[model samples]
Target: MKTIIIDDDATARLLIKKMCNAYSEIEIVSEFSNAVDAIKFLNKNDIEVIFLDIHMPLLSGFDFIKTLKKATKIILTSSDENYALEAFEYSKVVDYLVKPISKKRFEKSIHKLKSVIIKDSLVRDDSIFKEKQRNELYVSIERRLVRVPFSEINFVEAKGDYVKLKTDDESYIIHSTLKKIEAKLPSDNFLKIHRSFVINLSKIIDIKDNSVLLQKEIIPISKSRQIELITRLNIL
Candidate 1:
């Protein structure tokens, strides 16, 4: 991944660069002493990741992030840990590291960056596929064929002979089987976590033990399906 360092402290920048060198995947493309210079460089260059210092001379890291038109993954480095919560408000901020960053913590941040990249790539690829295939499902409701966009679907629960399609806006109960609906949904976004439940993997909030949290719902994951779900995640 192409990376850049932005820190007012020269020693801090050097240390981060040296640490990043340990990872063969990261290539240091540029270094800036202030947010202003970094912003100038970023206007013309495309970088995958940035090692940003929250406290800077002219513009602060948070201010610099607000000025960006494109979303770039940022790992915040700071002497004070107080800004950690605020830094994460921006979705672009991947990880926050305190000054005197340890090797283990830096490695964990790299893992997070890779996971974000993988998830983003999958989302983009799925979008392209949706465009080509016209991702709309035709469901028999009443006597008419209702059109439902694949992206709106949250999960499908088998209710005897009918399947309940829960979405962000509303729910629909159609005369179908879980297996049939699962076949239509994209494998990348949807997974069969239980015999009667097929969840939209993208909608997941957290996974703990045998339960997966989706919105306000806690859905159980069968023992056999748990392994498959974990395999799908980009874990380091």
Candidate 2:
């Protein structure tokens, strides 16, 4: 899980980080000494879990929970055990670790998280497998059907009579409509951002104003499709 540690005490954060590093499942993306800074990071990032302290200055953990735009899993790391019952009232608060935290206690909390993730992982893994199976397609070139994988493709553009498949290795001009090509491509990664263009969302390097940068090329995003594109993005 992609996680971040938030605690007022630097020592407690360090201890939690160290213990988290021992597990392969936890990937600590960042650490914050306060919830305010952590909230800023969370706004632009997709975080799976958070290690938060309850009695921090300025914002209490309960107060911080209300600021969230989306429900995010939080594990309380507190010195006090009095608020355990109250903390469990929040649906997103998974496990509470009373400080000073023991390795065994932390392991138990992680086990709880793992159980939930493992159940969800099965469905995600199957979807990934299905996505992988359709990674490539066959295109008619000079009367011969050539196989092309989606991984190598950057984007697809429509010419008057043909659709141009722009890939890393070469561009193939196929006598097909953009709509037909778009239908063949995977919907998760490929998006039709304009009337004449369909882009690979994963290949995008940056987005500025009304344009998306893909390696060396900048594709214009139609005002009509701009919101759909943004909604599809894993915008952090």
Candidate 3:
């Protein structure tokens, strides 16, 4: 993610940059001592994440969040733990780090950033960072929320703690269970043929023996759901 450090304290900025070095995903594009200059840079360029200081010389962290023109994820860093509650009130604020930030807590914040798939709202004026999630499934890949339409899904495979969403072009690994995702998918298209697999009925090429063929892949159909699958199909 293209990122920036916005803290008046040069030492604080250096520490944040050092902590961010552990993750390859975070690329520090620039650093700002004041929020006003950061806002100007934002107007001309696109930044994915921001490491902001709550107390600054020019504009405070809360004031800076209010000045954002578009949807962008922010991690607030402050010495005061008092603002943690107030910080969460803003949807753009992903994680609040109390300074001096610990290495373990920083790692947790990064993990949270990569796994956040849902939000009540992204930003004011309702600009949801090009991922509003309407009649679609939002998969968190890296630091972005990717939208996958139900029509493009060929099947879903359960992978322990995660589920793989197979599409015509690309496949995504989402942090969700098969049962939870099944509830979100429409009943007309998606059907659970097995405990570990859910297949899109329209994508099925043929059903042979106890398995169904979708595209080039063959998926097993459990005996318990065999009759249900047959009833759903238009058999001649």
Q: How much does candidate 1 score in TM-score?
A: 0.58
- For model 3, how does the per-residue alpha-carbon lDDT over 1-236 read when each residue is reduced to its tens digit? 89999999999999999999999989999999999999999999999899999999978999999999777889999999999999999988999999999999999999987766233233432665333443577778888988888888999999999999999999888888999989888888889999999999999999999999998889999999999999999999
Provide the global lDDT of candidate 1 against the true structure: 0.91
Q: What is the lDDT of residue 230 in candidate 3?
A: 97
Candidates 1 and 3, the one with greater lDDT: 1
Which sections of candidate 3 miss by over 4 Å?
117-236
Pairs clashing within candidate 1: none
lDDT of 1 by residue, 21-123 (tens): 8899999999999999988998999998999999998999999999877768999999999998999999999999999999999999999999999999999
Off by over 4 Å in 1: 135-236
User: TM-score of every model?
Assistant: 0.58, 0.51, 0.51
Clashing pairs in 2: 44-236, 45-236
Model 2: how far is 101 from its true place, Å? 0.6
Cα lDDT listed for each candidate: 0.91, 0.91, 0.91
TM-score, model 3 to reference: 0.51
lDDT of 2 by residue, 27-55 (tens): 99999988899889999999988899999
